[model samples]
Target: MTSGPDPAEEHSADVAELLALVARQIDMRMPEIVREMRDLLASRIDDLGGDPQLVEMLQASIEGNVTTICHILANAIDLESLQPTTAAVEYAARLAQRDVPLSALTRAYYLGQSMFLRIGMDEAERLGVRDRVKIDVVRDIADVVHRYIDWILQLVTGVHEQERRRWWSTRAALNASIILKVLRGDSLPLRGFASETGYTLTQTHLGVMAWSDLDADDPARQHELDLLLRRLATAVHSPAPPLITVVDRSTAWAWFGGARLESDALARVEELVMAVPGVRVTLGEPGRDVGGFRRSHEQAAIARLVALSSPRYRDRTVVSYSDPQVALVQLLTKDSTTTATWVREVLGDYAAAGEHARVMRETVAAYYATDKNAVRAAERLGVHRNTVRQRVDKFEATLGARGVDPLQVALALRIYDDLILDGGDVLPS
Candidate 1:
């Protein structure tokens, strides 16, 4: 006759049965567990939520990890046989692509492990097993899961680091870094800088910024912009290929090297840009040497800002730092609301909306352009000289009894007509 089962064997059977029971319970609550885990991560981690694509990746990672943990418990899968799920590895690579810190990624894993462990212990307790068996079951679950995370994390860490290194080593990434250092005025050997960037800093440079109104992620549009810039560089007879750095998917900065851009060169650039729908460009004044390189880019940046801010220039393709009124407008728009109020104070009734205001602005602008000569101003506006004189007189009088600064009044009129008068509505008033 068979002897009664050994106590050790019986104890082992009890633990095994309890572990499987807990795993099954957790499996049934998989949806809840996964949802809670995702919600918890999103609330605690900035990188995990808010983007639809990132959220999709997050869901795949959570489901894969949770399902694998549940399966390991149910099947008593050997810990040595475990590997990181494909989704998990892919998710890590994606985070690397987005430049999320490895610390953030590793923190998520630890958080997930804690969450899984808590669920497992809660399930074991709800199974109503004896305290000894409950302890044994939880101990087994914890050991297996902790080991799994340790192993998977080691591999995932390698994957993340490898992907990050690979991403930043790409030509575009490398060039972008070098350009940023220059833009920041970091000290570097000028000869080495030219060698590394294939761009000479001592030459005259025309700073240009190009952007598109289309979808920011459209690769075709970016390609078109690149082609347009190269063509522009060729048209301007750049001694070297244009130095271009993509600022984003839709925007890029470029430099065309030359002695100086002829007046006709700008006209040609505009003509080429007009061929591409939805594309816009801004150009800075030609600058010499390193100081010119930085200053020209700064001017281009300011021109871009002014163009972007103005509804009038929203559809116009090309703007330049040297364009009439752009320099002053750029300065005044730094504090838009204050400038608007100042404009209102200076222009008085001329700042208000209407045809009368428009006519008054044209007359005054032409008058200023003609050096306050009413005859020439009338000729420019195609209006009677008396009409120009009368408008100018009224405009000056509206500047109030103390009389405003003529220069300030000039700036106010320019901004009002260019920026505030869009759609017949006054902005920042």
Candidate 2:
């Protein structure tokens, strides 16, 4: 009938077009925006007495935020209500997991919202979006984000609270006691205690000391620490339910008992499990019997020390005691302060060379571990023999002839682990 377009429909169409333009602008700069937001959010979190762990966590948050925004801008009309996106809920849960006070999260949200508005307004002018719809589009976007945040916080705080109650339960005490006594080398019957602890002593076991890298356990994060343990146990398909003890708000000690342990268990775990936000897992080699149980636990404890005491290693989510070099490192770094001194003394400027230092030290260690055979070392390290030979020669050149001795070489390896692999960060305060 050639009727004029309905004014309401035309207005809606204009709004959608404006939003789509804004979304496009965001899409073009999303990568840079993510980096900026991560840094900004990290700063805000720090100001709020929160110890943020891992750049990866912030990266995930930014990606999630981008996805939600894109979805809303594309389908604003079809969406009847604002729903908390997966990323939003996960963000709240992670904050709770890190024991970051709820205020920190809300404060960060406000800061983020303010930044978004500023950016949107600036982009609106730059993009020459129509004035009639510009303010409305920004408001709609804000509304979506605000509603998502509110719904997510309400939902996840409940999850955190439930987990908190579970952590504080008497059952938690029983689990901790049974596991702690064994770790302390008490003479408990493996079977009897196994029945009580949901751990199967007869099966091969892998011990894990799972915890956050923060300086102290924040009570708020204990629930997430608890959940991290449970999730790991399930991911690995343990023969029996895992045995876990909450050591504190930031730390958990766990063991997975399996009828047969996978040879690539550590690799599998690194690929599948450790990438989950905010937790570090120090793993012991698989073993059996009560002795294996205790040994693996002790090894994992040593690996944790290596991981936490060095800033290089601190960033790593997984540390395995299975590697002979990692074990040797345990010997070198039994005392953190002393080992640090040794690394500085032995390697001199090279101790802090970062990745360069790791590659060289790894070459020498691989060489030594393979019985000083260059071909085998090359094979072991999966590098060309020439590369192995060159690194070894370079290592010797910097430290001189004495640096090549078996014992001296061993010390150098340990030093590298401390200064390079352990993240140069100081031990937790």
Candidate 3:
């Protein structure tokens, strides 16, 4: 032992000194390296790269991390003595606040670490150190970076999860969970949930689905929609504040308890709903008790689907389950292909996609809607009575060969209207 210096010790010291020199060189190029790292992370992680605010946070975090790693190599700092940078920790917390997936945050770190390791190795090689020295230095640098990432990742992951849990435990989030459970038809202790949400399940329920064409991730949009629902409840004279759950940033599901839009209030409610510039609302028919709660929400959901599918209702600010032929169309269009076939059989030539057939379908629909009064149908269609009579005669003559039932023909006409509204094939050839 006294006779010789240990070869392994000598190699380790050499690698350490070379790594320090390389780290200093890399430090000099920090701006370029930071740019490369930022580009790499942005290209790889959407949630990290998407928002300008998030991207700014990410840039700060990357700068802090890269600087820290350089200091670790050049100064021979003890890994255990290091703390995650404030920028890095704050970035992770911000991502959590926005409800970005934890896996995405963790993935950013691993990706950044890999890129950092590569930069270190490249710098070592560029220094023109001997092959053995380069290998040793690169290996040591890799170990240091791995340990640093592992340490920082643990801290950041913990921060993200803690923030997410804190966010989820907030009053609105808790209430949303309870409401979702009830909406899912879960057999919950109704009284407890009712008390917790300050909504009564025993009262009449008017379910509403409100949505807009906007980005779902914007908190401001969601807040606006929530305020809109509160204003709607006040307009409708609800006995209590409406219970609303944000279905997304752009959509909300609300229940107006103890309030039904009476005949007198219909005009006012419609006026208020239409005045809102960009939002669309679908209303379920009033139902009583828990059964009504589920039924009304289901009806609202169905109305939303049917409204979205129909060009007539698609742009309308308010679509109600009580609207003319909405329920009938919903029933018939449950099976579109079958409904198409039935319409073709019932209307015969009137189901054709040609303009002549289109007019016939419209005339017949108006005529049927107005109790088969040709005069009233003409008024509705903005056509002369004689024109209505002529179309009616043609319609009757076409269906006469099939010996159609009046009610069945009426239902088929409704489905055909929906098909045309959707701008799809009315019937297969």
Candidate 4:
């Protein structure tokens, strides 16, 4: 070297100096690179607030290398010589060691470039760059940017599926908790639960469903019913737990309960029942508390019976217990035989023969209406005082004289009228 530097040694020294210079430049640019990455990530994260999927994808991309990313960017900008700087090479090597995808890095690079271009475009315009140059840069940046966006979207979709599965698991657990409380007739402090579970508490909800069939022995039908119950639970929110019960297998008294259903929750439940082929479904009314839920379920059961008994009430997907006929049917069903017998005895043959039954029944109704005043009874019946007297006399005779006690007769007549009007198939004795 003292005589004359060896060619190989000289060349090696020059290469080392070039590599060191490149390393220094990369080190010097580290702050800017980190700042750019942070800004890009922040913007993307802000755009996807609380979106678990987007967060995961972005994280994956940041942990990846920039080789493929750099290649893609170079291709878009028509610059093939845009090799990775020392820092980028190091970053890629670290990511590869960690087993992260290089495509994720490419995605990050495009994202960073897009943000840079946006800021650069404004500065260039302020500095009065020519329109042609601005357009060319924008087009080049945009080409790569679109690819990056596509990559982000794809990554987000995958992440979303994963997040959805996680949320579904959480939801299933929450639902199970609520259902356990419901079975025990206990109320949940939903606000507290929501806070603990990190779920929105503003919208509270509940739902119910039921099923029935003629062939109770059909195992296939039972399996289908079980599947339907599971399907209903999942459809409302993914990975939901079963909230259904077969209250009475013989009568097909199946039921479901849950929270967070549509405003027309009952209708939605009925729609599910209707969709089930061959199986009869009855959707109960929607409600909040467990007690209210029980009432709604009872109503649905009554509605199903009414549908079976009367064609006029048939094929109704959602049977509201509030319907006049349905309510009457429920009332009669409470004590049908007793009610029928009472009706027959009160309005028997004698009362029907002389129209005394009608007069006395009307009189008693009016008396009760007027708080048991004979004067008011006569007035409302539009009959003479003695005419009302004659009718009362005939009623008393028919009711075995002892039964003519005005209070007793009045009570009986009232009960009879209620039973008959409510579709009790009973005639007066």
Candidate 5:
């Protein structure tokens, strides 16, 4: 027309026309691509056997063209060559988003097959870039994404396990601390321990003692002992509260305070001990204060020793200080056997002399037995009121004439009884 319409203007018009044509083609193809992608992804989801609701949501999003799949591909793909069809490009975008380990393999296979099908053998062969661009590029990108996702998942799982173990360790340590505090005869901070350990402090304090055969072959006895301590703790309650402690593998100690003892607490302890063969219990007396607790424990220890020496006493039961025999046993422990022997020897002659000697001995024995109770002694012997009076009179007369004090007679009788039962070889000589 006019020298082929100025060269620069013609070139510009040709570029604009080409760009418009490409935009129109994409607009027309996008709907079909979306529909195809939705169908394929739905089929894959069904094969995966995941939740139906999640699958349906993914299907609806794809069918609605909610994601910019084509744009995502445009950014990721090589632009030097003609791009693949929207379906193939969207498939690659979906695979990239999924970040699956084998997604690269799938993407490479699809890209290679799609390129082979779309281009004639001659064009693909001439490009010489087919293997590098189509196969290697997709594989390299997908591999990087897959490795990242795997690393992230592993990090999350590792962190979670570490936190769980720490939490458990903290809890165990707290429980042990609470138990130790109680065993030391210190008051338990129930609210504080409960808050820190995540355990209820109310009714948590208990008292227990552990005993094992001096010769038993249980290597796991320590573990068993802890279990027994926990069981006994659960069964007891107190205000200051009892706590568990391992005195040794063969012995454990528990203490409880601030709780009222039922009349049957001792009975219950005995029952529990009896059920376990060869186990013994030495229950401390209920004490209202620190001083009382010390005395109570001392009494319990002495009672246990006495009980061990006497076969007639029942096993696995509390021997209260108020028990008459138990009191006598404690008294004997407080005095020396040598002193008892001397007293018995010095008093024996007077006790053996006449018919009045028997009465005087009976009176002396009764005086000590009744704790010097003249009236109670009469009642115990089933004698006439005056007969006990007469016996007591004779006792004083015999001791008085011998230049012995009435108090000495009483002391000699106590020593005689204790020394005989204690199995001391020294007799009145």
Candidate 6:
């Protein structure tokens, strides 16, 4: 008697036939597949400074990466030594040379893998295989994909690191000068250099000022600062890799693009403060255009300056220019002489004294906000009204019997509360 088709043989046949169908159609579907990917990654095109050539090359490169996976699925190639292109390694090196951040470069790999998963699932459905065989094929493809991604990341990161050292060592000075020129708003055709640097001038920018009060002489610490900036970039979603200018060993200025700081980025930065020691950071609100770029940096400069001045705020890990007090301080005080003279004339002994003086400055500021209402000030301060009244009395006694105007005293106290700073990074670099 002749046996019907064997179950085991039938199952293997279905799986093989399904894989073959996908492989055949993968090439045919390349245009639609790649278009979907381009649509998903459209936001990133501008991050490459919106250059047509760079965007085109990035699209082509992603298509190549995806096509290699299609071949692997067809079983024509082993994933072992097969690279999508030697072009990836060369591209990594070229991006490094162009000052493109490693984070931004590798993001292309991640975005490709994401596209593969989404497009793969959709393509699997269209294969019209039996449900049982379809599940097995999808499961197996996913397993292999996870492994491929791990391998590819290691390969790309190793090459990128190797090239980055060479690039940074040679181009650090040139990059720094370019950053200075951009921030200074020195009239220059910045768009031409955008491709070379991978930083955009057309987008909104968030300025940052970071410094350490400790020693600046150590090159290692300076490198640590550089690493911190890179970490900050990754946290913020690579809004055009941070353009950093090292002012000295102790301080640096950096800018990242985006309309606002993402909450996760802010949260990650809070964590970073603990990881990187002795670092203080301040950020300006997002600003647009070339003039806005300079203004944003000024706001960051003001935030940094004010943070340094306030005894209460001295140990703060990060400050934002959006702080009303920071904005007020920046707008009201500009000259070093005027800044110092106003504080001395108003606060008297409190300007030079210890933490108690700092507390009194806060107490007085609250009092002003409350319109000299001791009860409201105490409520705002979470202290006893008597305590609020005593501080107010002491402030008035120090200011003298004639007494300064409540408005004037309030403004000076808030200024001191924000900073008793001497010529902070007030002047943007």
On lDDT, the candidate that comes out on top is 1
Model 6 stretches with alpha carbons more than 4 Å out: 1-162, 184-186, 212-224, 245-251, 262-265, 327-344, 347-366, 378-401, 418-429
The C-alpha lDDT values of all candidates are 0.81, 0.69, 0.81, 0.50, 0.47, 0.72
From the highest lDDT down, the ranking of the candidates is 1, 3, 6, 2, 4, 5
Highest TM-score: give the candidate number.
Answer: 1
Worst 10 residues of 1 by lDDT: 420-429
Instruction: Provide the lowest-lDDT 10-residue window in model 4.
Output: 198-207
Error of 3 at 73 (Å): 53
Instruction: State the lDDT of candidate 5 residue by residue for 134-219, as single tens digits.
Output: 34334433443344334423433343334433432343455566655643767766577556544444432223345666444452
Better of 2 and 5 by lDDT: 2
TM for every model, in the order presented, reads: 0.56, 0.48, 0.55, 0.34, 0.39, 0.54
lDDT of 1 by residue, 1-429 (tens): 989989999999888877778888888888888889988887788977777787778778988988888888888898678777899999999987765767888998899999999988888888786788888899999997898888888988989888865653464456678888888999877897788767898889989999988877764466678779878887777877777788877888998888356788888888999999888999898898888888999989989988888665766788888887788777767776777777778777777778888788878878887888999989888989999988888888876677757677666676775557544454442
Give RMSD (Å) of candidate 6 vs. truth.
9.1
> What is the TM-score of candidate 3?
0.55
Error of 3 at 185 (Å): 3.7
Overlapping backbone residue pairs in candidate 1 total: 0
**Local accuracy of candidate 2 as per-residue lDDT tens digits, 184-259:** 8888886779678656677678888887765445555565666666666666677455677767666778888872
RMSD of each: 15.5, 16.5, 13.0, 15.3, 23.3, 9.1
Global lDDT for candidate 1?
A: 0.81
